[model samples]
Target: MQKNDKIKFYSCLAPLSFLYGIGVWLRNRLFDWGILHSEQYPIPVICIGNLSVGGTGKTPHTEYIIRLLKDKYRIAVLSRGYKRKTSGFILADSESSSWEIGDEPFQMKNKFPDILVAVDTNRRRGIQNLLSLPEKDKPEVILLDDAYQHRYVTPSLSIVLSDCHRLFYNDKLMPTGYLRESISNINRTDIVVVTKCEEDMKPIDFRIIEENMKLRAHQLLFFTSIVYGKVKPVFPSKACFLNHKNIGKEDDILLISGIAAPAPFIREAEKYSNKVVPMVFPDHHMFSKSDFKKLEAVFEKMTSSGKLILVTEKDAARLKNNPLVPESWKNFLYYLPIVIQFCNGQSFDETIKKHIITFSKNNILQNKYE
Candidate 1:
């Protein structure tokens, strides 16, 4: 659709968006007035989520927190497991697949097998289950993934991420826009992170973002940019080893992505190769046999000798052990991992550590007194 047509379409949905906003407002008020209760766990619970509905790099930020605290304290991650086939509080194990748990949860479980990862629709119940584990196995710090709107569980330290490309302040409610709640609701968060920032972002850019956010005095703000890692084979056992820095101008890449934000990924891929053909599916899409066949066709048709297929790490989680993937495509398929690099790295680290330390000390005092 043209720009005008798109604007008209969103305009048409404005009323519905208003209705949705009312429902969200009422629910929040109920919690605020004590008509509905928001459960608070004694152990430190850190929530990493976003006000907008789509990708704000929650997973990488959550991983960043996990890496910061995993060594010092036993860590567990709980997610709503969006689009998973299973239900209730199911803990991840070696036998778990992306089908059983969501792709993001499964990916984290694969990367950090020692850490506890579980999924459930009910965030409160998921945390309860994690806390109920045997004394030695119980988690000391529980990371709540994508739980900003899950008002039932009050986190000890809530971090809300916003995409640099689409700040919540510039967005409306669902249908008309991508936000799950009012921009005013941002005050509920302890920290706000602007994700997917340019590596060389100017000081002026940060100032503009901070001014637009109008954050509360109690809230902290930080900016981060994506740092793409070396390309690794999705099927490492089946594919021959290739040097990570092998991609060059001569290569043609077939970039397959099932993510909310593909522009950044595509732009990064374009930097490596002259020709990049992207095949984008919906976020959290479960690739079927037809999707694999289409991918096989796209990769096979590329005439360049240095042609290969590339995907995001999240997509790789869903495709890794799938039976539908053509055998010929395995050798050429690779996934790029990403982690966030904070603008004020040391400050962000210190702030997270301080929250955890304070929580631990208070918990100890309470237990001793009891």
Candidate 2:
């Protein structure tokens, strides 16, 4: 069920949420008091994460950072590999599958093959492994994807994202709501981003959000909206050529998404076609043979002559190269790509670049003196 569908039960779960909040508070306090250490690395480490459990657009934001810095720096991305089958630190290679490295990481490796992508539950260990590489291969900067609560490694620049649709300020602790921790913890961040905002959001709406967040003078705030790219075939070899422009009112879209949030994706599909049938699944859900059979059944039942199967880029990562997917469905399977566009993009870019430049200069001076 969608998060909105569970809202009515939040009151009943309040007691459980309170207990969960207490445990979160104590753990954070331990780290704050230095009873639990947070390791600091010499190289620049930027974290893109959220206080909420999922659907804040962390992966796309991480990809944006990679695009910004990859030209000037050797970049490395470290993630927990959320639902992968493996358990140790593993760097992505040609042979790596979404089942092995997690879908997001696998997607990154495929999109930006030049950069380093590694996964481990231990953030510190993952960083150490990346740093141990030869000088040419060692990354100059490390991007931590979804490590906000994993306070074992202190990031040089911490960016926390909140979905505009479900702002953390309006949210509650787990069991009752989506927040992993208290909204007060947002004060620890260097930058806060409101993700998945409407492209044409009014100025008044922006001010309303800004006032509610109450960020510190030292913290930077930005708003970003999703920009859906062209529809690309998941299985290019057997795909029937189609683009977003080709989709029309007469079309019937069978949208298959295994993401935390599918509302936005469904809305996008609805713009082109009035008839949209969505098959929603849990985040990081692995598609099985039974699921494939259901998809086939659904697609075959659609009456429109112009019918297609649509999925998010993250879901496409898991479906790609899978043995269970039937060959007949390949022609209709396509995934939409999404990228973030900041309200004031130049300012956001400059802020990130300035920090990296300063870090590099300081590191050089320290090396000279030592």
Candidate 3:
């Protein structure tokens, strides 16, 4: 069920939320007081995370950072590999699968093969394992995916993302709302990125949000909108080669997704065709033979001549690897890739570059002093 559907239960469980908030607060306090130490690495460690449980556009934003610094630095991304079957530091290689390193890390490895991608639930040990590599193999910069509350390793730059539709300030603690911690915790973050803003958002809207956030002088705020690329076949086959944009207006689309936020993706697909049918699933839901049979039944029912199955890029990652899915369905399956476009792109880019360069200088100075 969707998060909004659970609102009635929130009030009934409001008291539990109070206890959850206290636990989160106490843990952060210990870290702040040095009772819990945060390990630091010499080179830059950039973290992309959110205050909420999910659906703040962390994957695409992490991809944005990879695109930015991949050319300049030897970059590595370390994630907890949420829901993966394995444990410990398992590096992505030729034999890695979504089940081994999680879907997101596997997706990143496919996109940027030259870069390093590893998964370990223990952030400190993960970093150490990456650092233990040969000098030439070690990454000069590390990017931590979904590691905001992970105070075990202090990131040199903490970029906390907030969904524009569901702002953390407007939400409550878990079981009551989506926020993982208090909104006041944002003060600890160095950068605040408001993701999924409308393309036509006005200058006054930006100012109003900025004022509402009451950000600190040191916290740099940036706004970004999602840009959906042309839809391509999930599994390339000779029989099916048409892109979503190539389809006629009269076409029917069968949208299948297992993502935290499908509203944005569904809206985009509707723009291409009016008849968009959704086959929704829970986030990170693994597809089974029964699910495929149901999807097949749905596809067979669509009487329209121009019809195809479409999914978000993340969903495509899992579906393509599922052996239960018939080969015939693969020919009809397609996915749309997404990227973040900053509203104030120049300022955002400059800030990231400056932080990285400053860290480089500090590393040199520290080495000389030692």
> Which segments of candidate 2 are over 4 A away from where they belong?
1-8
- List TM-scores for all candidates, in order: 0.97, 0.96, 0.96
Scored by Cα lDDT, where does model 2 land?
A: 0.94
- Put down candidate 2 lDDT per residue, 1-370, tens digits, no spaces: 6787676577679989999999999999999999999999889999999999999999999999999999999999999998999999999998899999999999999999999999999999999999999999999999999999999999999999999999999998998889999999999999999999997799999999999999999999999999999999999989977878888888989999999988999999988898899999999999999999988998999888789999999999999958999988898899999999999889999999999989889988999999
The candidate scoring highest on lDDT is 2
What TM-score number comes out for model 2? 0.96
Model 1 worst lDDT run, 10 consecutive residues: 239-248
Q: Which 10-residue span in candidate 2 carries the lowest summed lDDT?
A: 1-10
Report each candidate's C-alpha RMSD, comma-separated, in the order given.
Answer: 1.2, 2.1, 2.0
Q: Write the per-residue lDDT of candidate 3 for residues 108-221, one digit (tens) a residue.
A: 998999999999999999999999999999999999999999999999999999999998889889888898999999998999999999978899999989999999999999
Give candidate 1 misplaced runs (Cα > 4 Å).
Answer: none
| RMSD score of candidate 2 (Å) | 2.1
Of candidates 3 and 2, the better by lDDT: 2
Higher-scoring candidate on lDDT, 1 or 3: 1
Highest TM-score: give the candidate number: 1
